[model samples]
Target chain A: MRERFITLTSPVVPLERDNVDTDQIIPARFLKATSREGFGDKLFHDWRYDSAGCPRPDFVLNDPTHRGTILAAGKNFGCGSSREHAAWAIRGAGFRAVLSPRFADIFRENALNNGLLPVQLPAPFLERVFTVTRERPEAAVTVDLERQEVRFEGETAPFDIPPYRKRCLLQGFDDIDYLLSIRDKIILFEKQHAL
Target chain B: MNTLFDKIWDAHVVEALPGDTHVLYIDRQYIHEVTSPQAFEGLRRRGVPLFRPGQVTAIPDHNIPTLCQHLPVADPLSRAQLDTLERNCVAHDISLFRIGTPHHGIVHVAGPESGLTLPGMTIVCGDSHTSTHGALGCVAFGIGTSEVEMALATQCILQPKPRPARVRVEGRLPAGTCAKDLILHVISRIGTAGGTGYFVEFAGTAIRALSLEARMTVCNMSIEMGARGGMIAPDDATFDYLRDRPFAPRGAAWERAIERWRALPSDDDARFDAEFTFDAGEIAPMITYGTNPATGIPVTATIPPAADPQALAYMGLHAGEPLVGKRVDHVFVGSCTNGRLEDLRAFASLVKGKRRAPGVTAWIVPGSQEVERRAIAEGVRDTLEAAGFVLRQPGCSACLAMNEDKVPPGKYCVATSNRNFEGRQGPGARTFLAGPLVAAAAAVTGEIRDPRELM
Candidate 1:
């Protein structure tokens, strides 16, 4: 029932590795809760935390300078298990969007349904953004869902979102909500198929 | 110009939206303990009842123990997830097979064997191994928990159509080589992410000649290559495997079923978006040496110089290190990938009349209660027990290490499961993915020797 997506202005965190998988994003041991709460503390649990459960200073996520509301990870991010928890962890960690050249299909769908914007930018533009964010850590970036544009420091790059998905984001509607919009068609199909 | 993937996808489309997306109807859905809890909660939160409860089959596999069926799950967290699934099933009026049920097993194994998955059906599950059902000529794929909730609210998912890629494996597989080796070999060539943005169809003589059980093994690891799913065109072999199964069509319905299934293959002149050909004769007993499944090498081969150094360090192997003669502390022969009855027989046959090498703990767990029962009746249990290998109760034991069957930290485990990702068996545990024959050889020799060595 939770549904809403809008413009966001925040910092960015760039994970500069390809093929980062779901297990590395959120380790299996932390996957016990039925509730999708407090996963922020456990994102990258094994990498971000020490054996004593203290934050590891070496991990980029624990480094205060790399703070951001957006996870600018590498291509094929969320590559392994089809766990929705990875997307939930991103949301719980207070990230509103993810930017990558490519994303694993299941993870992309999960993020979209859970109100996390997945923006696919070309490698050159992504590298430029990475440089800009690293140089000016506090530089506020804007992602306008309505205009389908991502802007930072007077520089702008346009992105694409499925028209139906854009409409869903703008109207705060989930797939079930959209399906309900066309319930009659579904009913007709089921009846015709004689299910 | 339609591939088998397209034929199934076209039939399942309820509506087409802009940007090549479709409102697709799902005929059957399977659920397991690890991913279904939150989806069930979401359903309750939305006050949404299951549209057609019978379309879904829920089972708890990932968190259950293989040794004890009558005892309560020891880990409180695992017990709670299992309990949540059971409660959700009863409240939603969906069919369920709990821990002690004869029908309860790994969803991937149970679906095809129970005839719940058949040709021309669109099947889905929260677990990625749902691709295993695609072996039956279905549009089978994995869905996330959010998608699971969506399907529960309305038996449909919004999906973007994928282009089709055909992988052709020619030449007959040599004796001692299995479907696992062929798939591993293909993954090694294509890398882990090569199949992205496509629904792959495995073709050519080598694939068609595989038995249904072997075909399932090949399809189960389709997710490891990052494909949405992989499918094989249905033939007489597919129908023969399904005939007279417990959930299959019967009598007059059976005759109609075969007639419909016979038409599920791709047209003769159809075109695919992409195609890659491989020689099956080049494949051998395969094993992975790195964290990802793509880092596989043949049994007689050595690690490559350019292999991931981080993975090599974690695995305690150097470049050019031969896979054979490396000591293995444990051997596991169960998971959705290789836990079927044929896999069990392959393992048992290799170890019969031989002693399990000292200090090598071998766990031979079946994928289902029926598999365990059948194995016992077929003397697989007797043979394995004679070799000092225990036939554990049926569940996904030691695969993901959610239960007591974990391989100890820093130890080497020769596994028949799909993924060999770092710590997949347990924290700091190293896994080597192989076919059951390789796993059986490791069990008897306490090392990574080829199965033919014992023969």
Candidate 2:
């Protein structure tokens, strides 16, 4: 499926919790959906909403004052389960980028494939974003997948994404596009091996 | 000198790309209800035909209720996910182990027992515990859904190499210690992030002596410590287990396969990026008192003061408190981690003459139809039933909060499954991971008692 260039320009919300697992991101109870869409409503389901389905005001995601398209969490964000629903929910909830010190391996790939950019920022930069966004709730941050750099508060820092992943995010090209492009090679290999 | 990992990995590399990336040729792909729907939908939308449909296996484990297998799934969402898998498997002409089938079970359990996972092969599943196949000396790792799409379309995946960590364990374990305890001890010594960016090779005599189910239990939790996966070089024990499986090679072909498998072990001169050693003698019947699996300790040990505050608060435990006698409302003995025949037998042996504690709810699920059948054949189910513990149908039940078997919020459950992450079993649910024997002990005693105490 064709995705759009993921350029984020918005304030970021802090999920300050450490080792935020995929089950915590989107509870397993809500993972029964066949389609990936409509997961935004259930994003952070247990934390963002209560037993009665009432939004928890204390939760950062539901706090009307801390609105943004990016979620900033601590280390090992999206760590536990490999369910891609966590990524779908993150993207579905209008977040284009998740700024973290480091991302759990699989979640990073899942987020990138679904058009949600997982930006690895230095500890200081992460702190700066938290400070800037808190002092100025209207603070705007930018993530440029093409340049592999993130801009915030008049400063920019470089991050690394595989060249192919960068190209996909920039061109709205899914990894499948590359696989499709290399179809002849795959066919040749399979035929050669009689696989 | 090549490690077992490198040998299998080198052969699977179909193409090398710039920036240290390669396209890995996948030999087997397993899918389940939760993470696979999106990938199948993507394949449908992109009009990508699966390159090797015959090598793929699809099942519904995460969403199926452990009870009432003959009836349609009652929950609409569960029904929808299962229906989607059934529909996609039919539409794509892929093999499926739908509920009630002899082959039906957890994806990780069903594949290997059916001889679908073999040595010297590369396997990927949408579920994290796919590492369980590594016990057979296969290079099996979990992939995200999009990567699943890549494997489906081309029977390959774009990948970067992972560093190998040789985790060597020496000494014979005390009788009560199971594979679950051995792995918990490993995770505790190395925090949850210890194996990040690495594939762990669990080696040494202690790992070698374990039965296939036990080795699988150890490998199945590789993801809990953030490993790409874990493997044990397949040996005579692995060969003996695979001999009579339906999909396994027959007669002379079996000998040929054994010859190939024999050559797959690491060379003596092989090196790893990092090395860790644990003495099996020190490993006790373990349980997680905190939220993550890495925060576990022997059941006899006191809860650490440094346990995660959030975990402590959610679990309603005080620092330095004894975990024993902390009333457990639920005792779950199932999941890819400990839902096999051996796990059921362990539970049965523990609870044979005693009835389940009135306050504790015991949920016992077999890992596969074969395991379920064997449990009945061995009268393990009858033993469990006599002890007032029902042997439910096979599925990944209560391992995560996906299915109907969720522990009610604020309830305490001692589970034999992998993760004990906060809210893993349900919202506000406190999970303590233990071996099946430990879980059985807790069920009969209605507390976090050591399995050795009962033995």
Candidate 3:
């Protein structure tokens, strides 16, 4: 049921904060579900809503002018717990990609597994994007996974992802399918190497 | 030429693909209710039985109420999750450490204590603190739900080899400081993103001198620094800790296992992609002043002027202000990070005859039922109770506040659990991460007094 990632061009939703941990993306209290859907409503739950359940105007997500499929964030994005729900919440919120100067290791993997591109751009380029998005909320950014580049404001920058992961994302291939196909090799490896 | 990480990693390779990706075999997988339900559902969707059920162990830690072992869970959703896990394990033939059982606890804590986690193995759990097993010298890290399902389907996951980094802490730790202080200091020096994209190996004399439990505390928070995982080379101390654990090898098998583990350390000439060295003697009892663990300082020091203003605003702290006398409303002394029997003993020693400060609530939770039982047998519970600190049953209590042990909004808590991120404990709770001694000092003093002063 996952979408095959190829390319996305959309206005950027700017969250100018560093170390946006998974706990903030989706708080621990919301992790009670057995399924992967519907986390979008609770995405950034504490920050999106006040205790009275009203949308906080100061939060970027509440800004009606800035709406996009690509989430642009500051350095060290998704830097805490390895909850895949963070990716689920992002995808559930309709974000197809997250662009940052850097990303936490586990979150990067989780994002990729969920077909949400984690675009790691140069620090200066990311800063330029943030500035552009801040000045013009409707500015669109283009991300091309096939080309491994992000383009915005007359500037284009290349990003890097492991080639294997890129293949998985492009084909919508799940690791579980590949792993299931190679059960014999795994059993052979286990038998040959006894712990 | 092989580092310890390379040795453990290379040994687990089922197949090496292009771009340094390996189909790495997982020797053990720890499961909990919070993260495993979806993974189990994934298996059901695919119509696959667990590939190696014996290698997986399921436990319910997160969302389980620490109080009332005999009672049904009050939260219907939480209870359903727990029931689903039991049903999945029963259907799949995976082992379940049921609640109220002696072995039931946090996966990271119970995994090592039961000897299911061994050196030179590749381990994982759905939880981030799976890195805690790396204290026993494994290539353990947290995985997402998809990866969890992949591991369950074949006991193998495709991963790119992480570049290795070494953090060497030399000299001796100062008195009153523990492994928590050393790690907090490391994070402060390196910043939260310092370890991103690397597997960090904690080395040098200070790390070596730590007891195994203390080493677990250090490795438990590797994820906080954005590292894939943190590991310490298994030494005699590690061997000693695992020797007689319930599931560890016996007699000749134990001897053989130790021999293999002894050879698991990095060669003298092995090279790491990044290296850092710090003096352990200079580290004081450390505490976080901001929402991130990296925003830490020695208890007696003033907050840095360069501290993130937004984080400062969230924490209700000002730059250049000393944290030594800040009032704390609660003290939580438990988590996979510092919730072992050793941690409780350290806490009990600090407040043996003293009383908890009035209006300051303290929850002293152990990491596991076994830890709780040992604390009681060792009289650590009595000391904690005598100090007016209630000894709570083991779960991830108040660490994530999933079980109603939340600190009220805007309350300041000095916590031994890892993470000071906003709303980690509750929606508006402010957490100051610290060691057990520091938590004890805060519990008794009702403020952020240095543990050294109390000592």
Candidate 3 structure quality by residue, lDDT tens digits, A15-126:
9888899999999999999999999999999999999999999999999999999999989999888899999999999999999999998898899889999999998998
Which candidate would rank higher by DockQ, 2 or 3? 3
TM-scores, all models, native as reference: 0.96, 0.97, 0.99
**Which candidate model has the greater DockQ, 1 or 2?**
2
Clashing pairs in 3: none
Looking at model 2, the pairs that clash are none
Stretches > 4 Å off in candidate 1: A1-3, A131-136, A139-141, A151-157
Q: What do the candidate models score in CA lDDT, each in turn?
A: 0.86, 0.87, 0.92
Ranking by DockQ: 3, 2, 1
What's the distance in Å from true for residue B105, model 1? 1.0
In the range B219-293, model 1's lDDT, one tens digit per residue, is: 888888888898999999998999999899999999998888787788888888889999999899999999988
Per-model i-RMS: 1.4, 1.5, 0.8
Interface RMSD of 3: 0.8
Candidate 3 per-residue C-alpha lDDT over B207-283 given as tens digits, one digit per residue, 9 for 90 to 100: 99999999999899888888899999999999999989998999999999999999999999999999999999999
Give one digit per residue, the lDDT tens place, for model 2 in B1-455.
Answer: 89999999888776777766678888889988888888888888877787788988898899888998999889898898888889989988899987999988998888889988888889999878898999999889988888998999988888878888899999999998899999999999987877887888999989998999999999998888888899999899999988889888889889888998999999999989989999999999998888888988999899987888888888898889898888999999999999999999888899989989998988999999989999999899999989998999999989985888989989999999998887888888899999988999999988888888797
Docking class of 2: medium
